[model samples]
Target: MPKIRQVEIKSCRLETYSSKICVPLPAQNLPELLSVAQKLKELTPDLIEWRADYFSASDPKEIIAALEKLRAVIGDLPLIFTYRDYAEGGFVNLNLELRAAIIESVLKTGLIDLVDLEWQTKVQVREQLLQVARENKVSVILSYHDFQQTPANESIINILKAQQEAGADLAKIAVMPQQRYDVLRFMETVLYFNTHYAEIPVVAISMSPLGMISRMAGSLFGSAITFAVYGKESAPGQIPIEKLRPLLNLMSSP
Candidate 1:
């Protein structure tokens, strides 16, 4: 197998093909957002994800102001900006054009280290947003989520490849598993991709309670990042960061 590559952001280093815990902040207001960030700092998550879509304010200025406050509290910790659409189990409902504009505006702020863009976004709009992100020196994490069911291994692999081809610095896929084999297939696909294509980081998640093991054991199968919750779960199957941190450390230890 080829050697895997690591992604560095600020003082944090995400080691190649290893597990890094990410805590999602789903606050609806600035006060709540700062409170969450302050608390998670003690837990020591490798990355902090701001679920911007959940914020009650839709104005870009308000969102940026909130992010600035979040950055102040977190300091040098890597921050990922995610504005998930409603179709992908996100709380907020936004039109495609509006969503693209919001992401573009956020990328220009330079406060975030990584930005998460949905793989299903319109091609022209996606390219435009990616260009802006690149101009600002921000890494892009192209993501695909299936809240319904996990697809076949071939389909999963295709999605990962598509993200890489579309200029993503990291590729992420999260699927709901109906059976144990579905989770296994997801892991197998990730392992194959990481072993063969090591240029970009891959984040593979199998959602729902049945797939919790996938979250904990991601490092063994080449998943570079795993999402954990602190107070509220941004996704269906997230383990709390406090509990997940120790488990990930134990599993990833040499």
Candidate 2:
């Protein structure tokens, strides 16, 4: 087995062998954004993920300013900057180069703790952005999202291994499961990879209401971080942070 890695952000430590909660900020405007941040602060999530693709402003400067404001409100909490591509459940469709540029710009701001990069980005472009992220010391979460259906366990393991090979600090896979067995398969894949393959942290979830249990039970299977929603969910089947926090605590207790 590979050596397990641990990521420290603020007061929390995300061990490759452990689990934590991350809340997604899906607001589209300044007031709504700040409101979500303040409310999430009260809930005390382990990390804050700003789904930048959801914001109305497309300008890089405006996005940076908004992130700065978010940093002020969430003080010391880790922030994840994500500009998801529309092909993978995000709201907007931009030119691939434009999307890559936006991510590079966000990394330049130096305000975020991590950045989510899609695993499907072209190798040349992806490498360039990864280089920029490395220079800035920003951790990358190379992710794959399947909004329609879950793939076989072997395929999922390949995806995680690909992320590890690409030098991602964490690997995340989210799939929409059509049945209960798919959820189990997804968790099993997570367990297999974290136990037998790469040591990088993994965030695995099966989406939609049918896969809700995986979100709460992922920790048991070696998923390091799970996403929760405050108001609007960035992805399907995300539990509200308020409810998820207590449930996780209850489930984790002896």
Give me the runs in candidate 2 sitting further than 4 Å from their true place: none
What would the TM-scores of all predictions be?
0.96, 0.96
Candidate with top lDDT is 1
RMSD of each candidate? 1.2, 1.2
TM-score of 2: 0.96
Q: Which lDDT tens digits does candidate 2 get at residues 1-254?
A: 77878877668888754569999998889899999899888888899999888899888889889888999999999999999899988878888977887889989988998999999888898899899999998988999989889998899999999999889999999999999999888888888888899778898889999999888886688878988887788888999877887878876777
Candidate 1 per-residue lDDT, tens place, 1-254, comes to 76656778887666545778899999998899999899988888999999999999888888888888999999888999999989987788999888887888999998999999889988888899899999999998999999889988888888988898888888899999999999988888888888776568888899999999889997798778899999989898899887887898888898
Count clashing pairs, candidate 1.
0
Q: Ten consecutive residues with minimal summed lDDT in candidate 1? A: 10-19
Give the whole-model CA lDDT for all candidates, comma-separated. Answer: 0.88, 0.87
TM-score of 1: 0.96
